[model samples]
Structures are given as structure tokens and as C-alpha cells.
Target: MALTTEASRYRPSAIWQLRLSLFMATYVLGASALYPEVFYTSALIYSHKFLVGIPVLFIGGVCCAALIHGRRQPVRYALDLAQGRWRGCLLVLLFFFASLTAFSTYKIAIPSVVPYYADNWLADVDEWLHGMPPWEIVHKLDSNNWSSVVFNSYEVIWFYQWFGTILFVSLWSDEIARIRYLCAAALTLSVLGTVLALALASVGPVYYHHFVGVDRFHGLNAALDRLDHSYMVREPAAYLLKAYQSGRPSLGGGISAMPSMHVAFAVLNAYLLSSINRWLGVLGWTFAALILYGSVFTGWHYAVDGYASIVVVSVIWWTTGRLVRE
Candidate 1:
């Protein structure tokens, strides 16, 4: 994570670097036009979280840097922040929050717009590809002893990796790399998380029985029920269902599962981190593999969802890299 001399001296053009912000502005406007109530409600909900979460995340990031890199590194980091690095970081955070607001709003609107008709198709595709439902394969490998750990990795660690990568790249001195990462991330969410998800509106395996009125995943659900820490997965799934039913925009609410955003973001993190260094790349990919597995293991997604996400996100990442380099 050492800043290269070229990066330290390089200053990106304001318009070019603010591409994410501009994209988000256009997206927010478009979303508002289509779903004003959902857009505004999501904006309000996420805005509050933005105001409260930013400072806490900033402090936590600094503390972690201090603990990992020692006292002098924190001083240098603070100096960088004061020396105007914060502007870029602030823009990144704004883009991220805006993306979340837009993504969640679209996620909430998916069912109303398209309806959940892809779960059965996705399930069939998963079985066709894997010779059986992926969840069954995942369950076969699952151990009750490690269910909690896997759940936490999928739920809690995913958040940390998601936000932590944003924070890390936001502060990265490499302007081209930073812009590339940010743009790729925004595109991944907008395209894979929103557009394709809406096009292939599916409630995923966990909620398949509930939404589609079929017990297609009964064995998968039963296996989950047998897990020692099934509640970790069940509770959030229940909350999402409740929020969806209530037609309310809650924090981290909404569900569309064709292309797993968790897996997409994980893969995106892997690409960006690998560019920084080998070890980080390894760590990123490992976490991504875990997330891919957990997405099915928790019955939150079909195996094909994760598979499609990896392919689409890779293309998006590669395309964004070329754009930034240009």
C-alpha cells in the first residue's frame, strides 16, 4: 500500500475523477423519475446512515491503520487527509452511498416492476450446471460446528470487505487505479445488482418456497434449519421478507437474487486488491470464494447467481480498467 512517486505527484482531472458522482447523479434522477417515493425514502434513510457512519468508519479505519502500521503511519495518513486527500475520499464515499441508495431503491422496486419469476429457472439452471441443486452440495460439505463462522463471514465480514475496500481505494494515492476501482464498483452495482437483477427478478432459494408458493428448496431449507446457527441466516431473510411485504425502505432491505451482489463485490474487491499487491489479492480471492460458497450454503442465492456475477463483474472490471487508463 505504499504510494508510488508517480502516484504521489499525479493529480487527476476533476471531471474525470468525479465520473462516479456524475453517474450517480444521473442514476438518482432517473430512479426518482420512475419511483419517486421509493427513491426519496431510500435517500432519506441512507442519508442519515451516511452522516452517522462516515465519522465512525473514518476513525475505525485510522485506528486499524495505526494498529497495523504503527503510530507514524497514522500521522502520515492524517497529514495526507489534511493535505486535500480527503476531497477524493469524500467523493468516493458520496458515490458509494448514492449507489447504495439507488441500488436499494431499485431492489425494492424490482418485484413491483418485474415480479419474482426467475427463482425456478435459476434453480433449474443451478441443478443443470452442477448435476444437483448447489445448496445440497453445499450442505453436504457444511459442518454444524462452523456454520456460525461461515454465516458471520458471509454476513458480517462481507460488509467489512465491501466498505473496507471502498475506504482503502478511496485513500489510495494512485489516481488511475482509484478511479478505475470506483467506476468498476459503481458499474457492478448498477448493472449486475440492479439492471440484471430486475430483468431476472428472483427471490433466491431461501425465499423460493415463500414467494413462489413451491417447496422446491425444501431440502435446502431443512438443511439450513439443521445448522447450529441457522438463525443468523434466517433472521435477516425474515427481516427482508417483512420489509418487502411492508413496502418500506429499511436499512439494508430489498431482495433480488439472480446475480449475487455479495459475490460480485467480493470478486471486484479481489481484482482491485490484487492490483495493489499479491498477498491482498490472495486474501481477496479467498474471501470471495468463501462468499460464493456461502451465498448458496445460506440458500440466499442460486449457484448460477454467483457464477453469473463473477463473469459479469470481471467484464465490468476489465472494461472500467481500460476506460480509466485511457
Candidate 2:
């Protein structure tokens, strides 16, 4: 169970040091290109560093060492973890798998649009505050094409899922056995959220399409389905769509969309990050707010859908955290 202990004691071998350096290099280069203003024409030569050069180089280093050293490295590490282990790894993994499997196995025979009562309440509250003309004007000003505003919020979701999950869970978790639970929590709930998306389908209203005047991307469910089918996209978001395709068109696979899994996964990451670092928890809240906004703004979900997702994520955070503790 001494996972963190091992990492702290780890004086990285030359190969591991190289791998670590490359990983950091790739992250910096890739993230720097996110802002258009920072994109320098003079640095165009190094711009390509993110696309292939840095990431590929980093990936190559890790793969080479892990593959070449293989079992020679992780044995002492594994033996350390095996000590005082409670065998909770399998149970946690199975719990996660079973939750997903059961959800996938039996499709709920209800819902295409479970609108957010909470969002409705928020709108009302905001309006009430707006009775003061100046404040109302400000609220209105802040409420521009929120769909597009939220649409761009996808970056935070990915950051929490991939980066936070990897860094916090992988680093802070001292118990090798517990790592399995983290994985199970991450992979299973994430997959289950997607499965639930098919069953509930809370895409807000088609008025969204008419408002945006884009007839092509229709229903929230339809858009998700299309993305699922085209999982070959190089973009990481495409992989999420693919995860939704895991369960078939059975009772388990109703193609509805009540609670958004995108929200659920973000919630999971938030919990994990909070457990690892308080600062991360605060960042997660900001991230969650944007994700909630993104759903409705992008027309990918209704306000109700976004609200429902928030509720579901809250539930998921509580349930899974308990699983880890117990």
C-alpha cells in the first residue's frame, strides 16, 4: 500500500528521468497553443512541437523504458504494495464494473428530456435580482450566447479527467491496491455515465437548433450518436463518444439522455482531485461551473439537462467517495 512512499523514495533511473522530462516538455508545449494571442508567428517553428514533436518524443521515452525494463522494475514496487493490502482493489473494481454493467444491462423505460428544475429556479432568482434595473442590465449583459460560452468549456472537463485523474490519483495514492479502486471508480462511473446518456437523453429543446439555425446537428442524442459512430477523430473528445458505444441497443442501451456523463466524469475527477489537493478542489468547482454552462450554451443539452447533470454528479461524488473510504 506504500504507493506514494515508493514514489517519494524513487530516485529516478536515467531512463525514468528522461521520460519525466519529456512528459513535462510535451505538456507545456501543447498547452501553450491554446490561446490565439500567445500563438507567435516568430515561434511558428516551435509551434509544431505540440502537434507531434514534443508529445511523440515524450511517448517514445516512456514506452521504451517501460517495455525494456518491464517486470524487472515493478516487482519490488508490487511487493511493497501487496503488504497490508486489504484486497479491496478487486472489490472496488468489481463494484464500479457492476454499477456500470447493471446500468448497461437494464435500460430504464423512461425519459428523453428531463429538464432542470434547478436551472428554472436560477433563472427566476436571477430575474428577481434584476428588479433593480442596473443589476438586471448587468445580468442580461452577462447572459449572451451562453451555449457557445459553455461549448468552449470542454477544455476544463478534459483537463480534470485526463490530467487531474492521472496526476492526483496516480501520485498521491500510496496504496497500490487503492489505485485499482481509483481506476475502477474512474473507468466504470465514466462509462456508466455514457450509458445513462443513451437512456435519458436530456438534450433540452429542439428550439435550440432553430435558435442557432443549424438543422444539421439536431437532437442532443443525435449529436452524441454521430460522434460515437465517428470515434476515429484525433480529438480526445471523440474517445468519450466511443465510450458511450460500449453497451448495445438493449434495455441497457435505450439511447436516452437524462444525466450527462460528461458532467458525471467531471464530477468524479473533481472528487479525486479534492481528495488529493484542496486547491484542485477549488479549481474543480470553477471547472464544473463552466461545464454546466457549456451544456445549455452549446445546445447539446437543455438547462434542465445541465441541472440534472449537476445533481447526478453530486450524487456520484458522494457515492464513489464513500466506496473508496469504505
Clashes of each: 0, 22
Q: lDDT of all predictions, in order shown?
A: 0.84, 0.41
lDDT of 1 at 151: 94
lDDT of 1 by residue, 17-61 (tens): 666677878887788888889888888988998899887776666
Candidate 2 per-residue lDDT over residues 1-326, each given as its tens digit: 69987665543332333443354344334323432222232134333433453334333433443455546775454444334222433233233333433343222212223322232333344346545212223223233344234434664445435433433333233553234335434433433454445444332332323323445334343433333222221233334334334422222233233455555566666665576679988887677666655544333344445466667666655654454333
Q: Model 1, which residues run further than 4 Å from truth?
A: 1-15, 66-77, 80-83
Worst 10 residues of 2 by lDDT: 132-141
Q: After superposition, how far is residue 206 of candidate 2 from its true place, in Å?
A: 5.8
What is candidate 2's local distance difference test score? 0.41
**Stretches of model 2 off by over 4 angstroms after superposition:** 1-150, 155-160, 163-172, 176-195, 202-257
How much lDDT does candidate 1 score? 0.84
Q: In model 2, what lDDT does residue 92 have?
A: 31
Q: What are the C-alpha RMSDs, in order, of all predicted structures?
A: 3.5, 16.0
Number of the top lDDT candidate: 1
